[model samples]
Target: MATLRLYHAPISTCSQKVRLGLAEKELEFESVTLDLLAGDQHAPAYRKLNPDGVVPTLVDGDTVLTESTLINEFLDEAYPEPKLSPDGARERHAMRLWTHLVDAQLHPACRVVTSAIAMRPAQQRLDREQVLSDFAKVPDPALREMRISVFEHGVESPYFERALRSYVDVLETLESALSSNQSDYLVGSRLSLADLALVPYVLRLDHLGYSHLWQNERRPHLTAWYERLHLRSAYDAAIRAWEVAPAVEGMHAAGSAVHSRVDEILGRA
Candidate 1:
């Protein structure tokens, strides 16, 4: 077997996605944990492997893969038995579409909430200049600006409101999709890349104490889909362990304190 190594942070949603994919394939690999909160991801050595300096980088022999969705697809193709892609071209297209929605909509919104609620407060406790410097290290110019705004202003940042609204919209989309699909997984009756792509975001919703947004009597499909994900052993082995990280715990605690504010923003209050 070719050697496989993953560099990741425990609480990172992207990292969790990759981990779940690995676990589902019953793949054994070496783990290299990066302390994202401590600025480990921004180090020059790591940046060589991932120019964006993000977590959940998969290194298989000479090949280095970033981007959680792509990495998950790679894992699936590499180990086909518990296949993570659907059999037909149409189903595969749907799977890719779902993953695209996550990247295009859900992921950025999740980052805004995570930064505004959890990471911003944590950053405030650190050196201000260093925090700004860290924000500068983000490779994407637009994302860098958003991070800087949330870092400086926390909930008062304009992006927070946008993030809140975006999340609501995405949840509505997910609820409708799940209700209409009549499948436990996102794209088909079986678990596929689309399901793995989204599971981490669902876990993030729960961790952020925002589960009630879609866990109500009216959103049975969304609730049921989430529950089905948890029933998988890979969910616990690959994803759940990270939920208890000290940084993640701190974020969750911070998220709990802002429950009323978020509800008000979403008009759930």
Candidate 2:
């Protein structure tokens, strides 16, 4: 194994996914912790490695990889033993579809909702101006606006409602997927990249106080699927064991209100 180095933050879901991949492969690597709440990701030094200012940037020898799902694929391809990706083309496509759903839908919504309800309050306690300046450095214009809006108005911004809907849609999709399949994972019986891509999003949903969407009697398949994923040691080390901060505690409480609003909209209450 070429020297592997991962730059990540403690609570970042994308970082958690890559960590799960590495841990599952039993790969030894150096861990570089970035203070995301403190705006360390925007520092000049880190930007050279990943201009997007994202966590879980993987550096292997002279090669560098970004994007959590893509990074997981690269790791599996580079290290074949205990392969985390599937072999058959159809299965591979199925796995990629789940990853795509998460990267395209769940992740963006999770970002907006979590930042609005959970992260903004904590960040407000720090240097507000500096945080604004750091966020300005974000490469995507739309994302920059979303981040700023959540901070300025908290969950009252229209973006939060859209995000909440996206979260519900994702859970409903997961429930359907699990109901149609006999396998424990999103793609098949054996764990694959799809499961790795989704676990973090599900964890974020729970942390955001929205676990009731699938944890109840209505979505039994999703509930069982999550329980199966939880039993994995990699999930525990990468996600479950991390300590929650005071800001996140406040966010979780705030998120409960968001959940209630969503429940009313969906008529689940």
Candidate 3:
């Protein structure tokens, strides 16, 4: 077995993605828990590994890698058994793009609602003005330009709300995509990283009690995709011992499940 070290936190979507890949690879690692609740990620030594202060950093022998998608691709390509990626070039490209939409784009929509908008007390609902203000804080010039482009298209726009609605729409697109292919899996035949990528977000929906938001009445096919993943041992293992991302944005807490076989592999650390 390779010497693998994973730095992770339970409630993180990105961390969960990497965990799913590791489970699929059937590999073990030494896991060090980082308490994002304590802002431990910004502490000096840990930041050396990931300047971005993200969870689920992978250290494999001499190679230290971050970014869940890249790390998962690394695991899949390197191990190449019981694969989690699409095989052909075009198929892989589509998988990568849509996976981003599910994993990356839908992420903010889920977060904005959980973090700021709805999850708060009735007295503490996010201020509409502040929501727009939060939208305005993206200082990147390129990002500013991209937001401007959407407004120029004659669509109602701003950075955050526009971004949120786009992601919600992407779910509808996913529903249509699933509708055409009766198979529960995303690519040609079986589970791929695409399915894995989307599954975390599906569980996110369930955890958030947005389960009704996607299902037979709203988008039946997408609901089926969610159900297919719900049963997998691979995904089930990754999710065990994890917290549901907090209902209230900015508030973090300990969750119910403490550990699993994944924890056992790392626990022997």
* TM, every model: 0.96, 0.93, 0.73
Better of 1 and 2 by lDDT: 1
User: Which ranges of candidate 1 are over 4 A from the true structure?
Assistant: none
List the global CA lDDT of all models. Answer: 0.86, 0.84, 0.64
Q: What is residue 261's positional error in candidate 1, in angstroms? A: 1.5
Q: Which regions of candidate 2 deviate over 4 angstroms?
A: 244-250, 257-259, 262-269
Instruction: Please provide, for model 2 over 61-117, each residue's C-alpha lDDT reduced to its tens digit, 9 standing for 90 to 100.
Output: 999999999999998989877888777899999999998988898899899878887
Off by over 4 Å in 3: 117-160, 244-269
For residues 138-246, write the lDDT of model 1, one tens digit per residue: 8999999999999888778999999878877877888899989967878878998888888788778777777787776767888898899898998888977656676
**Model 3, range 1-269, lDDT digits (tens) per residue?**
56999999776777888888888778878888786534566666877898666677999998899888889989998889988876788888888886678656776555443332222332134454543343344445554354333323211224434554555576777888899985677776778888777777666545544455576478888887887776777666777656544432223221112113212322331
Which is superior by lDDT, 2 or 3?
Answer: 2
93 in model 3: Cα distance from truth in Å? 1.5
List the candidate numbers ranked by lDDT, top first.
1, 2, 3
Q: Top model by lDDT, which number?
A: 1
Highest-TM-score candidate: 1
